[model samples]
Target: MNAPLSLTTPAVSVDIAGVNLSYGTNHVLKDVNLAIEPGEFFAFLGPSGCGKTTLLRLIAGFNQADTGHVRIGGRDITDLPPWKRDVGMVFQSYALWPHMTVRRNVAFGLEERGVKRAEVERRVETALGLVGLAHLADRRPSQLSGGQQQRVAVARTVAIEPKVLLLDEPLSNLDAKMRVQVRRELRDLQQRLGLTTIFVTHDQEEANTICDRIAVMNDGIVQQVGTPMELYERPANLFVAGFLGTANILKGRIVGSGAERYFEIDGGTRFPIPEDDRIPDGAALVFRPQHATLTDQAGPQDGALSLPCIIANREFLGASIRYGARIGATEVAIDVPFQSGKYLFEIGSSGWLKLWPRSLHWLSV
Candidate 1:
């Protein structure tokens, strides 16, 4: 087995203190503070207009901050121009010239820097090889596939040997399968080169799959930052919980703690609380679909948060069965393995849904 890559020092680190931006009274980014380790594949994930792309532009020197400082390699470059900052950016649009050949496009940055003709050629060839586009060096952007064109754009950026690589939804144009394929390649290339990469995307799966750590942002504020598993397992709040994946939130209030920990839900249902030191009075319970199960068995039972639910609908998802159950006026989603041969419950069928106490996450109300 290949040894893991060691990151001795951070290739790029960003420290934004009280960073804020505004355009004629509209506040975009508000006091955003974040740090990215060297050789780490970091992702800024959020919905559109959440200031993720704006942050990327700030790091790339395309936009200047109004209050905070931007640093790369421990040096402040807030006042530097885009060309002076050694940061390579790949855009969603692929931004390649139609008239230029792949090789010429990759060589553009080096040539503009007054690099020798031979050295520019060598760099262009090397970058193209890195992206698996060396065989198509003579083709134009219009003649290549979406994936290939993206690779050319990547080659163009890496040819300049920038200190940080900034990608703003670079795979948004590709189809689903191609997006997956290219994403894996991008991660591999980033690892092999040991480049400090910052990727911005609204797709949660993309962020989770490629990044060493992800910063979840909403409405110009970073909600949480952690590894994929950490974020999935323990979201900081309701927004982080629902945003990262589908979650079933139960309105509840903590009544006790320790071995006698308990919580009371809105429908006058009381259940034992999960083993956690963070529980407090008046908190909410959250769990994912897989964390809760449904059964046709009887009433309130032991070791479960049992609730009477009527099956509203069912959908087969190949690997699992998804059932939409109506609990009072709200719908609760449940998932079961497809191979278990559990008979599909018909609409209007009533049953008890049991949620293990350990799977519940309690948050202050």
Candidate 2:
């Protein structure tokens, strides 16, 4: 399982510096910059049409940039065509040739590269063996399962032993349960090969589970880049906060002077800002649902801000309970650990959301 691909070079770094791409009047990628470390599993995470796929193709030499350079292992590959770039890309659809057997599909790339007959057979066998699909080599793409087809696509790509592996939503077509299984397999395969891989996906959970780090994108812009926990806990802005997970963003006016500032939640109570915290212009109060707990009474909560809220709705999650409450002119969600036999808060009941002061973040719009 180790070094089965017989890669010529060690894992290489991919640097996209000042890259910008557009189509006439439509701007796609905007000033995108990233440094993918050697042998690191990285991901471009964002919604569809955020230029994630375009960026991946750009690295694979399928898309050209209007400005900046793309360097692979310090070599300027910005001008090379796709085949000469020494990069392998697994498309979203897992584009398999239905007419070909599994063995032929994986061997196609090697054959096209003018690889020797003996070498092509050896590499194809090794690639299929690496993916645990050698037994099904004679089966056609239509005869294999969806997950199997995807592995064939991966096998074909790795058979080339490219410097960098680019995956564009490779798991999007599978069922939820199959997706979980295949992603773990993908992670294992990547680790065994020590390949520097870049995965493009809109699903945050997929990126968080397997990738080493993620570059969060939005509107063709690189909004923020960090580990999954970093982006979720300390997001750069409102979009990052809301996109990563369920976030409660309360917008309102700021009252009082410099040292005595307060966030007045629209038609609701004023929450005092921490003296050490800085509030940017047009910033809103941001916090995750789990950061706050619901209580029947406001008592004295040290280092916590108690917001008076009325329980408007409730949802029973397996491990926790989610409560939708109304405070002032806004609605926010609160999650409490579910305890069997514990008295549930009634709908329309007046309660308080006990928010930890340390968990609060003031972010701009």
Candidate 3:
């Protein structure tokens, strides 16, 4: 039997530089540049029609870039065809042939390449075992559940021992519970095999859960690329701030600048701004839902920005409560920890909103 490919040497790295793509007149990807580390689980995250899938296809050699270059393992493969690239792709549709048994589907790639019959059988068995489908090899795709069919698709991709694995929203079609279960299994399998993998998803939760690092894209441009924590805490711009989580934006003018920046809201309410040199004389203030608090206490404390507001609505979200309040003409959303001891205010209840100055982020006007 042929032994499994060992990744003792450094695994292959994928790189793209100044990549651009267009279908006739409509530009899809615009001057995109990214690097995927060897044996790392990297994710491309964005909404629909945001060029995330197009970028994946470029890496897999299914679509060529209109400009720039694509390199694998430090070798330029811009002109290489799909078959010669040695990349495994798992699509969202499961793409399994209904006529072929699970074993034949898993061995399809090797069979087409004219691999020996004995080696194909051995590799197919090994791949099926890896995905926990060894006993069901004789069953057709129609006989398996959605989750099982997805696993078969994964097994088929891995059977060829490709240099890189590309997954394009492979779990999107499954039910919610099945998606969670299969995602855990897929992540475990990828880590155990030490395969260089690139995952594309429109679901932020999925990317945050499985990816070692993620690149957030929008409108044919990459907005930010970092670890989950980095993207959540220090987003590069307004789009990322609103995209990753809920953000409360406030308009204000810079009253003071330099080390001790401060701003005044519409009600002449003064608040200290976080130390950011980029914020000019006029800018907007942005903060997360958790950063603002609805407290009974009045007056300003050290490092706190106070605002007068009336509770407009309250929503129950399991362990936390989302409170919507109106401050003058602006509405603010605040997420507070659920507790029995805390005072539960009714609608139209007037109170003071306290926010930490350090938690506030400045945005250009």
Best by TM-score: 2
Query: lDDT order of candidates, best first?
Result: 2, 3, 1
Q: What residue pairs clash in candidate 3, if any at all?
A: none
The reply for model 1, stretches above 4 Å from the true place, is 1-10, 252-282, 299-302
lDDT of 3 at 182: 94
- Candidates in order have lDDT scores of 0.85, 0.92, 0.87
What are the per-residue Cα lDDT tens digits for candidate 2 across 1-365? 52367888999999999999998998999999999899999999999899999999999988999999999999999999998899999999999999999999999999999999999999998999998999999999999999999999999999999999999999999999999999999999999999999999999999999999999999999999999999999999999999998999999878886678888978868877777777888889999999998888786497788888889999999899999999987899988899999889999999988888789888987
Clashes of each: 2, 0, 0
Model 3 error, position 166 (Å)? 0.6
* Pairs with steric clashes in candidate 1: 10-38, 11-38
- Supply the TM-score for candidate 1: 0.92
TM-score of each: 0.92, 0.97, 0.93
Choose 1 or 3, whichever is better by lDDT: 3
Q: Write the per-residue lDDT of candidate 3 for residues 1-365, one digit (tens) a residue.
A: 33443433456898999999999998999999999899899999999999999999998888889999998889888899999887899998989999999999999988999989997898898888888998999999999999999999999999888888999999999999999999999999899788999999999888989889999999999999999889988887777878887988777677756666667766666666566446744567788999888888887877687888899999989788999988766788998899977777678999889888678777765
